[model samples]
Target: MNPPQNPPQDPPQDAQLQADTVWLESIRRRIRSPSQRNPDMSWENNAADLIERQLQYDGHRTWGFVIYRTTYASDADWAEFLRRLRFQMEDMFDYFNGRDILEKFALTVFEDRSLFDGASTDTIRQHFQQWSSTAYRTEQQQQQLEEGSGSGGSAGRVSIGRSPRYRFAVQVDAEALHSVVHDAPAPPELDTTKKGWVKLIDKSWYLGRSEGKSDPLEPIKGVAEEDVGWMKVPYQNVMTEYYTKCRSPNNWSLNYRRPPKVAGSPFD
Candidate 1:
């Protein structure tokens, strides 16, 4: 008679650990080279390079500015432009070990004319600082409740709490500005302004918890609620995935699965 066959067995724990290590290494490689994942247009790349260079040398500064010009024929085009900008900023922040610092970042959009006419960066900066302070307080309160000994109070509070990320401010409606395209080779009469001017500043003024802490380099999973108000339908769905599913550590691993894209989503 043939020898009795042995029953099948699960893989050894060591083998599983080795597989996980390999997967994590792959993710690290990807994070190091974001350009390979999303190739930017020539102008877009230039803009991103400018911002990255500024951060590299003057990252300690509380605020900075960049001039951006884009040609958008429709609302969809505008949305795509904003989405690309978001991704580029995220990559730059991660590259400089500013992932945690990103929470204190704020963006303000402006028309070229306003910069030369009457808009004040100081006023905008002050408002953003106030908003960031309120958000910080809210988060602290929630944390305290989560750590409380009260049974019922902390019960179903096991749910993950929300925290503020990026905040944006604009004078006019985003959709209304879709038709205002700026493709001029040179900036307008104002030497310091471009058709599209964006102010990127730190609301925390380098006084937050992330002041000296460095978070692990990783991809930004979703856009903040304040940013979603400026995005279109497809981008909104992307934000949903980021807020709901991508927040978990398990989703950061290589085995994480992305949800199906919405009908017209530009993302893969």
Candidate 2:
């Protein structure tokens, strides 16, 4: 009888650990490197300038105290808000930069008073001070923020709610602008066309775009009030697969400016 063969063994413990460490480092580098994800990021405008420009816009000056609603618990809510505001600020930069409207447009963030306990310009500036003082604003600049808010007469008041949200005080060519595009339809398959359906294929739900004849049993559009089953999939997962299949890359030609009164206002 032939000798029995042994299965291949994994590397020794130390070797295996080192291999894992190296693999993790590689992933970290890839995530940190903007060029890996956004090819045009090298030429993109820095985020700090974007925030300042947006704050300086005229709309904020005229529309004092634009209140926004939030869902964050009061515990360290300011910190959470700041972190998200930074991300939104980055998005604003990417959107405007892609549209070639860097100078002609601006976007600003306002603190919701419901969360901040009637935070005035000074209160909001103080929060920014804790995290972004040296980077974005100085103590002197707090006064400036007050001047801008007071002069414009537009401060963001806060509201408490289950749905956490923020406001983008958008300005175009020194005018208080909401969005350039108003009520633009969502994904056609999701709204107008009976083309997409949330169907289980291979044990996973998808916002799939149907072909030829539509799936009558699984309609694509939203049903009146309740959350749609397959549409309930996490946004990130849906976008990941959707973008891979239908990658609409941003370029100089894309317009990211949104219309005013895009959603019901808390101020209203």
Candidate 3:
């Protein structure tokens, strides 16, 4: 419901696209052919495991060459890349499994650009330049993307593989939860006691009102820490059911934040 916060800003150079011809070729190969789905491809395999392995082997072989040359890391340094690659892979696997293992893997891999690290900012920018200059390098015909080059935005690297619909599930009314008395305000279930007071029930936030407080004009204790994240927007998408028909007794459970308290008023 909250507007997405802007990510921390990196320098303009960090926004550049990967310009390595070989890497580009490798990506095109995956998107276009999907090797396991094809026959007559020498490296194609049947099992998902085999297909994944082949894709990784070929993809990395091409990418490793481009990364080494573009970043100009020595052979030994590239060899050491294994440590970083393994560590990164472990982190990725911990969060998401196989499909995530495929696309998002590269974006994070290049994040700090150390495996590809070179000199000062100037040289590093130049290193990025080498990868982004597709016109100067060998450019491949993008078949699957018959739409010509993607007008891919800054988050393209990550967004390419993220969920198609909304990434986070929203709940308008979470289960009726009861907590012990502290009497600072009304429990969230008792919405009728107050006016203009709404609960933004992110799971991380507790939605109960003060134990005995009934005044909506007064600020509630559990929610109003100046230090925490507070947001005004409950739903920007008016099309969302949360905005149109968010009420209890209807029993629509999805996108549920917190229901109005079913018990006595907060001050009671």
Compare the candidates by TM-score and give the number of the best one: 1
Residue 149's lDDT in candidate 3: 49
Off by over 4 Å in 3: 1-77, 98-118, 133-268
Of models 1 and 3, which has the larger lDDT? 1
| TM-scores for every candidate against the unseen true structure | 0.25, 0.22, 0.21
Off by over 4 Å in 2: 24-67, 70-140, 143-167, 170-268
Model 2, span 193-220: residue lDDT tens:
2111111111111233333333334332
Stretches of candidate 1 off by over 4 Å are 13-15, 18-59, 62-65, 70-72, 91-98, 104-110, 113-268
Q: Where does the lowest 10-residue lDDT sum fall in candidate 2?
A: 162-171
lDDT of 3 by residue, 1-268 (tens): 9999999975565334444555656765666334433322322222223324533432221111112222332434333433333443344333233343233222212324454243232233344444444411122213213323465422111111111111112211111011111111222222233321212222122234233354343233344322111121122111122222322223223333222322113322
Supply the global lDDT for candidate 3: 0.28
Error of 3 at 209 (Å): 47
